[model samples]
Target: MTSEKRESALGALQSNLKKGHVYRREDLLISSNAVDRHLKQLLKSGVLEKLSQGLYYAPKTSIFGRLPPKEDDLVRAFLKDEEFLILSPNTYNSLGLGTTQLHNKTSVYNHKRHGVFKMGNRSFEFRIKPRFPKKLDKEFLLVDLLNNLNSLPENKDVILANIKKMLTNFDLIKLEKYVLLYGVVRTKKTVLSLLHDLR
Candidate 1:
């Protein structure tokens, strides 16, 4: 492509830019034959930000300043698939189980990619799982809380005691369902034991 024509193609690619949306190099190639060269120019001009090797995003601005990419947008582009869940471990705090740990990490549960990946200023820990809830609910969080008990810094016995006392607060059936669906062996045994004691 001639320099003049290449600039025109690059301009077309830029016209379609959506703030807060991530794009892979392959996605941009559809619009510009001069991808590599134009990518460098775009990055240098701050029109596009490099997220990772082949991942890039158009920066979004707000009164607060330039906002980082959304968790879903970032992960979707990174995995190249939308079938994943992004959650913060701190979210479990809503359970009101005397847990107040704060974390700067993001955890992704998906059928693809395992291990930590740094994209821009954020860090996402991806774990491979054959299954995960489509969304969050109190019951699922309760089950997930137990599922990840070993990793919690709080005293396990205390939490268990509190759970037994608060057991009436959750739907027993949903709790059981999530446990059977998502729990590891230890969670299953612990939850079943707790339920059995109530009988």
Candidate 2:
């Protein structure tokens, strides 16, 4: 029977997810229709939650009843596809770096704007910016640091110290390469000088 099969499938999924890991829809299904129906049933029953349209997770329950991971983590988990990355306004706030005046909306960037996705109480606004630096190399890293700096408290010493620490781990050559490629002149100058002093 369809009901029996669905129950069996849900059980299998629940068992696998008991390890506290997240799984993508495709990874859990041999047939798409089966996944679709089963996911709908589970979501309705509150046995599973829709993190994103195609992404779902088993909620963690506590004395508070159900406790979800922070918004950023939920977004990141839902965005397991490498083509997209989650960029929440509270990314810095979630990481204890800053306070976010906007909590209801989060932004994400990849290569294309994928529209918006709403999951439970939150809504995510997705957009595509130019690709991030190839890896976490210095130049791109500085851009990331600067981009997230508004999250930090307004303390000059703390800001400079954080900058110095971030610079210490940078690759000057790669930084310069991206600086030239991206025309990030201000960051280029600041990082180059810092690298010179650190050397």
Candidate 3:
């Protein structure tokens, strides 16, 4: 490609990279040669930040420093789809339960990509669950918290008891529905037992 064509392609590509948005090479739909040249130029000029292979983002700058794109945006670029949920065990701590331990890993419940993946400066634990919430909800979080209880480094009985107490404060109907639909068999059993105790 001529210098004019390369510059034109780069301009077009840059036009599409909205700030705080993550992108993939294929999303540009430009010829491979031109796309690569343009991307290299953009990267060299600090206009675009490459997160990984074929994935890039237009950083959001702040007074502190350059802010990375949202986790969901990065995951979308990694998975190439919006059908995934990113969560962390630390979310469980927000329930006011007695558990106070901090967790460093973030979990990605996605259909594709099963295993841990290092994206940028963070690590994501990808799990392929048959069913996962399209969006995060308290009810779903309660259910998921129960579902992964066994894997947590805490006292199971104590957590269950705490969850039992916590259940009384949530919407019973929604919690029940989430347990039956999104929760595993063990979680269902625990939730059912807790509900039965309330009745």
Off by over 4 Å in 1: none
lDDT of candidate 1 over 45-164, digit per residue (tens): 999999999999999999998899988888998999988988777988898876788978788999999999999988899999999888878888888888888888888888888898
Order of candidates by lDDT, top first? 1, 3, 2
User: For residues 103-133, could you state the per-residue lDDT of candidate 2 as single tens digits?
Assistant: 5556666665577877666777776667664
Best by TM-score: 1
Q: Rate the local accuracy (lDDT) of all candidates.
A: 0.88, 0.60, 0.84
Question: Looking at model 3, which ten-residue stretch has the lowest summed lDDT?
Answer: 28-37
Q: How well is each residue in 126-185 modelled by candidate 3, as lDDT tens digits?
A: 998888878888889889888888788988888877787777788899899889899888
Q: Which rank order by TM-score, best down to worst?
A: 1, 3, 2
Model 3 has an lDDT value of 0.84
Query: Quick one: RMSD of model 1?
Result: 1.3
